[model samples]
Target: MLRFAPSPTGDMHIGNLRAAIFNYIIAKQKGEKFLIRIEDTDFSRNIEGKDTEILSILNLFGLLWDELVYQSHNFERHRNFADYLIKHDKAFYCYCTKEFLEKKKQEALDLRIPFRYDDAWAEIQKKDNPKPVVRLRGSFEPISFYDEIKGRLEFYPNELDSFVILREDGIPTYNFACACDDMIYDISFIVRGEDHVSNTPKQILIQKSLDYQKQLGYAHLPIILGESGKKMSKRDSASSVSWLLGQGFLPQAIINYLIGMGNHTPVEIFTLKDALEWFDIANIAKSPVKFDLKRLRYVNREHLKRLNESEFSLLLQTQDITIGALGKLYLEEASTLNEIREKLGLIFSPKDIDVTYEGESFKEECLKLFEVLWGMSMQGESFIEYESFKNEAMKRSALKGKKFFKPLRILLTGESHGVDLNELYPYLRFYFKDILRIKGEK
Candidate 1:
């Protein structure tokens, strides 16, 4: 089985989503049961509804799981395993007070060395009363495991010491619960970020101490870096899935960009279904991939271009093909749905003629054009061909070249510079009655 374990402490990170994408796709390819584990054991830090938010994001991307397990639900079993370790002399309870441990840590700091707990008490047959927490009797030998991505990895015995398993409040720590739950859920393969590499040997030690020997597969993928060449952080607005959605990015575009980043693909653009056919682990780049927002915008534009006429209209939340055609025209100017909407809004909103263009004569020509178009629309000409409107308007103000077309663009689109007026006029011509409605026209 494969699992995606997430802690609901805050908004989901892009890296966490990457992990989910990889695990879900791999599980589908291998015909294995995929599970989602909400690792909310640290109740102190978990947000109230962050788990539901995480699951909803997964749903948005179509990553359905075969099983859903909450780590907190297995508290009883976790306590039992801790006791089993105590009975087998593999773990022990320590009476060391907080002050005592702090003193030991202080000594290590003063000596400029690492602090390690005394494991001499691990083998004591006599049980101590009033102990605060349970700790593992860590092994003194080397620890190693074969990783699917990073290859065979090894850690020295000094790298780990006697660490807490069951806390004073009887709750299992992260590594302890993760190891226990993996065994309980029959999860043989674990794929997560490279940040978890240090915890592997510690979890392995716990499994070994409990006499549960299973070969676990791991793929610690390199994390995503921002365009600035640093680790992606929460402060980066692009790191949030909700932010991306709010910016009007299509879900399939996001999936394609993520899977296609740092990997070889059959085509330049594809859908999630397309990825299911060709995704291979070997093709993934071993180095960290950068999140290029510009490339993502280009990919979104490509996805938008693939929509049929009906699909395009539906995506704009309109049944009118004019809006869809306008969307196509503005696709050259913008990428996202929100951007297209913004550009379309500019055409209908009132234009500010107070701003100057080249000089007084240029501004005069623009006002003259607006006056003629407003007059044409008010005369109830519901629609007119582009050539007809231009011929009639140019007859009144015999301006040509930059003198005529520049002001004409300003009058038509409410911007001094934008898409070609010829291309913008067809769908826009249909809206002329709405676009040129000046109340006090001369």
Candidate 2:
């Protein structure tokens, strides 16, 4: 069994989605059970709609899990585990107030030494009856564990303080809740980001104290860095899955981009089903993966090209009529659906098309060229094809180069460059002729 745990604090950024993909793919490829556990014990920071959004995103990417568990549902179990620790002398409650701990922390800082709670608190607790916070009694010796990604690692228990299991607010801390749930849920494997490495030993200590000696596999994935070479964050707008989707990125394209991040595969364009055949833990790179938008756009464009005519048309229709009509015109020219939409918008919603003259007879020649092209189309000639029209227009107008095509391009698009008028010729002819007739320029 494997689990993908995420806190419902905010929308999942790109890195979060990638981690989920890693765990999800591994589970499916191995024929094992995959589970989703919402680590929502930190209720103060939980956003209202984040939980639903997380599940929606997972479904959007086709990451279905066999079971769903919410941590808050097991609050009683968590409290009982803390009490069990206390009964077994593996943990104890300390009545130290916040102010008292703060003063002790400051004194330790002044001495330039690390602060580990003196177990002397345990001796004092035997004589006093005071409301207290439960703290786990970690071993004085070093704790070691094997990591699938980073290999073997060791940590001295003294490097950490006797951390809290149950806060004074009667809430279980994250490590405690995660440890208890992992064991109870029978999770055989744990996949998480490298930042969680520090918490592993503490969880291990808690498990050992409970006399649960079964060892599970752990894989701490490397971090994902942004374009600036720093850790990806929400402020980096492009790093957001919602933002990417809203920009007209297909879900498969996003999945491909993320899967390629650590998989180190040469196959650029692939579907999620295709990826299932070769997904392996050995292929994942230990180095941090860089988030590159240029590569992502290239990947999206490749996926777009693979869509059949009906699929392409349906996707366009879902967005807008202009896109549905003009999308195929510039399909090859666009790297993203957003690019196609923007181009169609420019054609349909132009502010103005200013005519530029390269010669004294440019306007006359251009209008005459348009009339000839329309006449040829009406006469059932091949002028509907841009190449045939351009050849005929050049011969008939006795014009060459930009003096001929540039004026026509500007008149149709109101821009210097865009989807080649050749590919756009059929759609543009009727629309342009209607506009010319309406404006009395025909």
Candidate 3:
């Protein structure tokens, strides 16, 4: 079994999405159940509907889970496990006030030592105290676990000190909630960023004290670094999955870039369906990878080329198949839907012919060329050879050279200079009526 327990906090970060993908792929490979556990117990911080947004994004990327659950729904079960530890003398309540604990923590800093819980606090009974927080009676012994990607890992006893499990208000801390739920769900393996490595030993302690015997699997990949070599922030480009999708980055491209990080693959570019065959955690790079937004654009371009005409149309948000087909012509110069839309807008948008655009020197010729084309334009929506049409228009207008091509070029492609007319016209030919005559015109 595998689970992705994300909080409904803001938009889903790129890191969490990568974690979810790794877990889903592994589960699918092993024919095991994959589950989504929305860790929404921290009601104070959770953003409403962000959970739905997360699932929808996962679906957009084709990551279908075998089961789904909310961590808050298991609140009673979490409390019960905490109680069991208390009854077994594995944990006890501490009446230390927030100010008091802060003083002790600061004192540790003064002494230049790590803050470990003062055992004396538990002995002090305060009648004024509200519901006290529960703390584990941690042992002074080394704990270790094997990580699938990182290999053998261990934590020393001095580093693993007694910590709070549940707050005075009956709210479980992250380590407590996550550990309890992992056991409750009978999860077989865990895959998350390397930042969570320290928390692994603490979670292991929770299960050991409760006599839960399952040895959980773990794979902690190196955390992604921003260009500044710091952890990702909102300032970073790839920080928000929602923002990336909104910017017209293909989900397949994002998946391709992420999967290829620190892992060997059969190909540089592949669909999610193709990844299922060659993905292996053992091949993943154990080093931190830099998230490059530029590389995503390059990958996006490759995916754009793979798209058929219908997909091109959908990418541009158009029902007109001609507009969609024309979008493909701009693919060589565009990597995103937004970019292609700009190109389509340049072409399909009714060209406003200003005879004076070329100055009075050629204004008369421009006017004559426009009249000739408009008169012969709006033909049957069938294809027309560009040379024949342009040549005849030039003959009728009695204009050639600079006078001929410039006016015709502006009329066809909204640009006075660009790819030759022969290359653009065939794909754009269907939209002649749309381009030549303004709307509400004869």
Candidate 4:
């Protein structure tokens, strides 16, 4: 069995999404039962809709699970486990206040020493005192575990603070809450990011104290870095999955890009179904993976090219990039939806033609060409005869190449270089009169 547990505190970061993907892939590969556990015990940060949003995004990527569990729903079970530890003398309650701990931590920092918990309060009894927080009575000896990815890892229990199990507010801390739920859910494999390496030992302690019979295997994937080799942040491009989706990125592209990070494969373009066939746990890379926007764009382009015409049309409609008959044509030429949107900018928001030529005085020639095109359109001609238009313009003005097409291109699309106006004539003819009425068009 495997579990993809996420806290509903904020938008699902790309790193967390990758972890979920790894877990889901392993679960499917092993034919094991998969579950999604919502760790929403932290009332302070747990937003209302974030849980739904997390599940929605997972579903969008086609990562499904067998069951859904909320960690808060098992609050009584968590308390009971803590009580069992307390009865076994494996944990104790500390009456330390926040201010007291902060001052102690600062003093340790000033002394350039580690701040291990001085659970001295366990030896004393102060009746009528404030509520106490339950703490694990960790050993002074070293504790070790074998991680599937990182291999043998060791942690000195003396160096680790006797971290809180339950707060005075009767809320279980993350380590305690997650460990209890994993035991309850019978999670056999624990896959997470490298950042959670430190927390693993603490969780192991809690798991042992609870007497979970089954052994838990762990695989901590390498951290994902930004292009600058630092941790990813919102300032980075496409850092937020929701923002990426809103920007018209297909979910398949995101999934392919993420899987490609760790997998050693010759192929760049692959679907989730293809990924399931190729996924191997041993193939996951140990080095940090860097997030590159250019690579993501390449992946997006590949996915765009794979979409059939009807699928492409539906995608455009869903994104509200409707351009009538021209949209389908643009989709054929565009490598990405963003590219289609860029090319269709003029159609969406028409601008006055900037007919200011660099030096040539070809306004008269361009005006004659427009006059001919408008007359033909007004006569119910829906298509442009490019050769005929060019011949008449050249015969009238004795101009060709850049001098001839450059000015007309600028007038047509408000730009000098873009989609060939000759091929775009069928669509641009509807806007020919509108382009001719621009203030600067001669």
Best model number under lDDT: 1
| Stretches of candidate 3 exceeding 4 Å from the true structure | 352-368, 378-383, 398-403, 417-420, 437-442
lDDT per residue, candidate 2, 1-442, as tens digits?
Answer: 7899989998888877887887888888878999999999998899998989999999999999899999999999999988899998888887877766788889999999988787676445444536688899868899899988889999986776688899878899999999999899887878788999999998988888888888988888888899999998889998889999988889999999988987767587888888888877667789998989989988988888777656776877764343355676676677888788677666544323234444333455556655665565567665567777778867876767877776566556645567777767766655654323212332
| Candidate 3 TM-score, C-alpha based | 0.92
lDDT, residue 138, model 1? 74
Model 3: how far is 88 from its true place, Å? 0.6
Instruction: Indicate the TM-score of model 4.
Output: 0.87
The estimated TM-scores of all candidates read: 0.91, 0.87, 0.92, 0.87
Write one digit per residue (lDDT tens) for candidate 3, span 32-103. Answer: 999999989888999989999999999999989888999888878889999999999999999888888899
User: How big is the RMSD of model 4?
Assistant: 3.4
> CA lDDT, every prediction?
0.84, 0.79, 0.83, 0.77
Better of 2 and 4 by TM-score: 4
Whole-model lDDT for model 3 versus the true structure?
A: 0.83
lDDT per residue as tens, model 4, 1-442: 8998899987788888888988998898889988999988888888999999999999999999899989889999999999999999889988877777788889989999988778785434446457888998876678688888778999986657678999988889999998888888888898899889999888888888777767788889888898999988768756788888887788999999998986786687998888888877667788888888878877887787776656776776753222434555664456567677676665434444434546445556556555665565577755357666657655655567877787567556655666666766666666666655444334
Candidate number that wins on lDDT, 1 or 4: 1
For model 2, the stretches where C-alpha displacement exceeds 4 angstroms are: 122-130, 318-333, 355-383, 387-401, 427-442
Tens-place lDDT digits, model 1, residues 1-442: 9999999998887788888988998888888988999999999999999999999999998999999999999999999999999999888887676766788899999999999888764334234436568998877898999887778999887888888999888999999999999999988888899999999999999999989989788888888998789999988889988899889898889988988888889999998788878887667777999999999999999999988767778888999977888787778879998998887777877665667665544557777787777777778765456787677778767778777887787767777777877778877877776776332453
Q: By the TM-score metric, which is better: model 1 or model 3?
A: 3
Which candidate model has the greater TM-score, 2 or 3?
Answer: 3
